[model samples]
Target chain A: MKLLFSNEVKEHRFSLKCIPHDTDMQKIENIDVSVFPDNITGKDIDSHGNITIFGYTKELHDSFGFDVEGTASTGLKDFESAKELHMVGMYKYQTKITAPGESVLDFSKKHSLESCSSNEEKALLIMQNLNNEFEYRQGCTDMDTKAEEALKGGCGVCQDFAHIMLSLCRLESIPCRYVTGMMIGEGRSHAWVEAWDDNRWIGFDPTNGKVVNDEYIKISNGRDFRDCLVNQGIFTGNVTQSQTISVIVNEEQNLIHD
Target chain B: MISYMDICGKRDRVEDMEIYTGADVVNEQLARYGVKFGIYKNNEFKEQLFPFDMIPRVIDNKEFAYLEKGLKQRVKALNLFIADIYGEKKIIKDKIVPEEFIYAGSGYLPQCEGIVPSKGVYSHISGIDLVQSKDGTWYILEDNLRIPSGASYPMIVRGIERRSAPSLFTGKHIEDNRNYADMLRHTMDYVNCGGHTVILTPGRYNAAYFEHSYLAEKTGAHLVSGHELIVENDHLYFIDYSGRKERVGAVYRRISDEYLDPMSFNEESVIGIPHIFDIYRKGNVALINAPGNGVADDKGIYYFVPKMIKYYLGEEPILNNAPTYLPYYDEDMKYVLDNFDNLVLKDVAEAGGYGVVFGNKMSKEEKEKFIAMLKAEPRRFIAQEVIDFIDIDIMEKGQLLPRKADLRAFVLMAEEPMVWKSGLTRFSRNPDSFIVNSSQGGGFKDTWVLSQ
Candidate 1:
């Protein structure tokens, strides 16, 4: 199956703000993206893994809107890992899960997870633990909610789930990374984890508590949600702005890779 | 003792003693020259003049040469360590430095992975602080690999101080500190991809805002704020006052790593360019003293720097670290616990002389509380031997008094590591205080390296 991922992000500011423009929403290489209302010219992939699309008109604005669409070729291949991993794979993703610091370490010890034994087993165990531990309550956690906060409350969205999973996996020395992508399902934006193992990277969805397949379209990857943030912006004003973002990933049957 | 008066001789010293005697006039001139520092203390923001002592701390030619070699070697090993940390874990895997110190460290950033700077140089400008003991052995006090300030202080002040009393410098052959700006320009250019160089400053409210602006003026690079810069087509562009955008190939950004890009870091930072990090990630621009260098300078990691020098360069370290012990190790913790009153404790996360505490000065209750904190979080603190360091003479109230001082040497890493001949030798004004940071009640002396 092929897929079409789309989003329309509208930011409404009550006051006239100095429009230091922002182009944070990325276009992944696996997907071809198109923008609506035109004139949003600059589009470039950033350092880690994300495309930065700019709408650069620095004049003060009351409201700004962007319409984006990405059509990608999708197929569910065998669950085999990549052949060769780079030297950076060894310890790069072994980041300190500082948010839920000691608890994550305790959780790993409690589970008796040894990553050297099996990345598949440890990743699945971590995902299951996260899914069981927390309830997917949307309004219960905000963007500022850390892993420990969410873990303590036993509630959060996909970002919290991914973060908690990252914490546990890293504590196990699994070399896990945070990933922001679309899974061709009914949801806003999504977050997951990719654990490096046996010289390859494999995706795991702690939010839904399952192994990721070709239905998943990767946009960006980093150590945590903070590193792979989808969109961020600021302007000159004492007034706060409201953000309205809608992301849709629909199946497209005809757009298969030739 | 080794003093400037010895090099100039009593005749030249008395003739140029006008420069030392006319301190009030030089300070007034410094105030007019906009040599100010912004410090926030007790919730109050105050901009005050960074007090300059007319009396210069002079190091003879032979001593400076040794310091230069040690500084260059130390920075080289640190750079290699950074590269190795980001690339292969050969050092960590080999157990030269424990893995916990690297991953568990607050300084380490996973976001810096896979990033090999244009020349494999992570810490392009390292500010290594050293202090001489009574026995004449200089030990490195701290390694500041991140956006190290105070270079411009010595660079600008030496010129102003020399002009204040030309007769003082007429007979003495003091190595010119003017080349710092040129060295900065060269370092920026050495890493430049294709476009022009720009100095990215947070604003005038920062502690070293004067240094930021002064360096920009001296280096002839555009001084830009987060607002003036924009990320477009995977490259950084600085918008001029006339609204014309010029491509920026290299940025000597003064902004902290956490506040450099709102899209990539602290989301609420209005002072950061939204996706400028994106430009850096794509190799469109070079960031001076590349981000994620804190891991190399982490207080805990400082213990293993000598080991890194041996591991990376296959050479014995010329410089010695101040006999320091991290509370993380069982043996070191025991040593710290036993010798509680003799050592000075430093919190790894805190900077600017805020988190330092003398063990001998702590009251019983305070000591107990500190011990509890240390036991609870061993990685957070490190203990060091308090060197009864040699005091330098500073003219205070027309009388020369001994004051504790430390030298901050600027090492710029371009093709090869170059140690600036002169350094910013800051001294504590208070008799009992060991902290010599500008934020603390301290003054600075112009460090003069003798030509002969």
Candidate 2:
């Protein structure tokens, strides 16, 4: 990630949620993180268990950046006990960015989601329906776009797709969360949904109409897109600022086996 | 209950009468001290003097004892509720408070999960508002757990009144209210992380800036803003004017939680110290009242507070919450619709006397529209039977006028809950209005707890 300020800015404070942590399905190994200007950085875990790196730059600078590199081994693991899921209840309710509107409500009612038998089934059906409905197009929606607006627009990125799926799944009383991470083919970070069924969290990629497997590496998960922001910051510059972010994932097995 | 005059005797009553006649003199001293609250109207900021009424609201010793116990119990239960909401959530699992109420309220902060504050305290300072009805029954009006103000107003007023009328203090058996600063300091010290204590204020423009500065002066803690503070090495430091770094142990932050940390909360906040919450999460520093306490004081959650007391502490609530009905429940919805004209409806998302509307005061068309809104978003509104408050006498323009008033009692949490002996008695200056918020043109009085 890189941030370019049109004018020299001082007191640049930033927080990044780009580092992936060890989860039930992913084990992060050999992690390295570096923030530009060589300032001291602090690493802490947020309420959602995501690794957060935060720091302040007191010197004047026109540009700043940070780099994170890690290896994540992804596969299914033992399910956590139901008693330990302290934050699962939060995902059952809709957030501001995921709350259903007239369009989403109509879509859910047309599908008759209430008659669905199980949480997993309801979630899969919503994923399929969202994949078929939404166009995989950028610029149609931004970070502040709500699920209802994205659905009405008929096109959005992975974040909007994940939000719409979350809204629909929650409407059916299925506890679901939004996940931000990287996939093998995608050159950038992606967003998806994880629905808690029975006693385990089952990942679903509504944008691709597929279940999350070993190819998908999870970074952070929360109630909606708001919780999984990769990078956010504030500074004293009244000058225009721009940001560029990219993510690349490769398998160690392929390099070794070859 | 003995009246003030009866307790003071004839000789002392003559001296006390001089204080009542000298209200203007007391207010002058208050003005010189910059005791005023700021309010915004149409995007314009205005600072108005919070008029001081000389006649104090005297609570009998026995009545105050009951109130002290009830306030202590209520604050303790509330603290436990906040801890559970962010920790084990046993209250939600036990079905005492529904999951929807916890997550749907905007007060629920996802960034505060699984973290316990220093000393395991949430609401280190709680201001619980209560009013006495015409039947002489005290009902809890609201809970201001997060950054509750108005205590300093009464605290400052008492000192001026004593200097203005020395006889009222020497002859009368009223508990000295000047000990609020000591109680506040102890609460902060009990949760200190082994460094200097500071009071974090947003700026001079905040509504409670007077209180923030006054309490800091009294408690002898440095008052600093966001820019004067820095986070380094996973700890908070205050940069003094001499460019020396001072570690801050406990912060009685007067800013709202969302605006306290730009990195962890609202990123657009310019008046917040970045990474402060990260250090707080690591237990390097203590935030007074703690973040995420809003979840417990939300109006929608207020209906379940008495139940929380029963669930968490296994005790019956000593005080009563005013007869309130949530439209979220079907039975309550029916009752609200049937008796819509007799109840006062409040929006759960609003505060500071903004979103309250009496049903009988609305026009027919407006009532229909409001009822439709009430039906559409049932969880957004709460209907309550309006409690007829007993009129408290305020000497306005040299004549005693009857007006509605409420007491905001402060409770500071140390090893145990300490309820202050005096409270801020705010009365609506307008005779017909029930809202006594200082922002809405209300005057205040000192609440005297009888020492006998």
Candidate 3:
């Protein structure tokens, strides 16, 4: 059966009041942002399925306001009367693919299935079977939803599908990871999955049975969707602010001409 | 006459215990065994040199016997109190302790109501702090019913001390203090669910990680993290390296109650085992120092322990209190407000040596602010008269000096409450400091209760 892979659709908006503390305001220079890329395909990445070249940041890498920055004063301070800042972003993408024509039990039977059978191969088989059986549906699951729940539901967004696949892979002893990025296609935003096959990592679009190609751009990789959300913040101001997001995805056709 | 002052001088008068002091010293003993404890400051992990004084505190047999009875009685009453608070609320209903005082206290959890522990005991291990007055009267300082630490320190330090002070042991027959591991193993077995026991830690960065690892090594329990445990079909299991799963009999978890189960307590807790509470509720596993025990350890509830002893055991308290005043009571509130400068005001909600404001240390503005807070939230605070306890000499910058010290004695309650022969004796590093908390720059010494 042909498997349908759906991209994660994240419509998120937030406002942060950056209060000028005696310490933090002077340290604040410029805000760096890494928006999920647009216009990408499934064939460009390695087997482990990692694409690190997608998310872009203008600010110095040290000032990215995350744990890598190691700044004590990174988050918005608890201050009064500060005009709270707001940011909004959204994601959407889809791929059509065919599942590998082998059940996990059948695949294991062909393999040694001995006492020395590697956990990694077992995990790959499980992942392959899960992708083959489940249909990707948006808004059917959330970020906190576990893989077992997603599998039981049989339909969920890219985040849920990836998490379910990753968890099953992990259960089989393979180190699987979640990837957040943009696919160059006729879509608003996108996300996908990466798995470690043997010593090498590989990326495949379960939604559209295709290897990730150079057309794909990568943003961040984590255990789940909660780790790679584009933007996260904390603010103290009482008044809430509204946010809106817009994205345009198109393939760069004239690569040699440019 | 070898006065106590002379013995103190013999220990603290030298640059190091091995060179100057005439005591039989085991040099670099803890370093040899890789025995160390960890503490956290400003979110940074630091290893602390486990302070050991060659001069151990000696309590006569009679004094120890009396202390054992009082400690056992106190722990039993506390366990009963916790069971009652979580199940029947009988203590509150009988007006022995105020219901508002309990509900308003942050430690009380309504979610834990009607949930019974495996052995009907709330505090499997209790660390109760006490101090000796100049007149030799013992006073109860506080109770640590939830995740009490430092038992392994005493257990490990005694091994080193026994090797060094062979003469000290010959004169005074001290009972074997090595049965802590056996006691702990038996305690876990008492509540076993037909599986292996494990010590759940929040990982190596936690302040009590050393204790967790040490106790797990000593008691033959697996030291595991949150990622190691899984819940399925309302049963808790540990996933081994070979992918073989084993049911967990008991879990002596070092993490706080709130961080034990993400689904039941704090949803945002990443270090918690998800859905493990359901397994514990289903009687598939036992959680040592079970959840909702904080309600019994509340500082407000501490004031009524003597009363609880009378109410539950119909016996008088052997140890006295240091004149604690609960602000929730009208007359006590008035008394504390009138004499705010002479007492120590402590927030009932805070623990581990925080939220304590000494009346004498507060400035005028601070006192006023505290008074305003007292008026705003009366039940949240308590005041106590500072007891002048006897000072002991400790080594400081290679000098013999006197400093305030206190003892945190462990009371084990399994089938019954049993006090260990030895306890942890902690002293303030500063000469003028009265707070001997490890968080507040204190050092610990070996306690030896001599047997007759």
| TM-scores of all predicted structures | 0.85, 0.95, 0.63
Off by over 4 Å in 1: A1-30, A39-98, A101-119, A129-139, A142-144, A155-157, A183-190, A200-202, A206-209, A213-219, A234-258, B8-20
* lDDT, candidate 2, B267-336, per-residue tens: 8888888889989999999999899999998899999999998998899999999999999999999999
Point out the higher-scoring one by lDDT: 2 or 3.
2
Arrange candidates by lDDT, highest first: which order? 2, 1, 3
Q: Which should have the higher TM-score, number 1 or number 2?
A: 2
- Candidate 3 local lDDT, A1-258, one digit each (tens): 011113222211111111111221112233333332221111112112222111222222111221111112221221112111110000111111111123323333443434435544454455555567778777887656665566566787766656655554443445445666545554433556655544334554555544544444445554456545444322222333333323333543433312
Per-residue CA lDDT of candidate 3, range B377-448, in tens?
888888999888878766554665777888898988788988988888888877778888886777777676
Root-mean-square deviation per candidate: 5.7, 2.6, 22.2
Let me know the TM-score candidate 3 reaches against the reference structure. Answer: 0.63
Error of 2 at B41 (Å): 1.3
lDDT (C-alpha) at residue A60 in model 1: 45
Name the 10 consecutive residues with the lowest summed lDDT in model 2 chain B. B7-16
Docking class of 3: incorrect
Q: Which regions of candidate 2 are displaced past 4 Å?
A: A77-87, A254-258, B5-16
For model 3, fnat equals: 0.00
What tens-digit string does per-residue lDDT give for candidate 1 at A151-229? 7777888888888887777666667778777777665678888887875677889889888875676666767765555
DockQ of each: 0.19, 0.68, 0.01
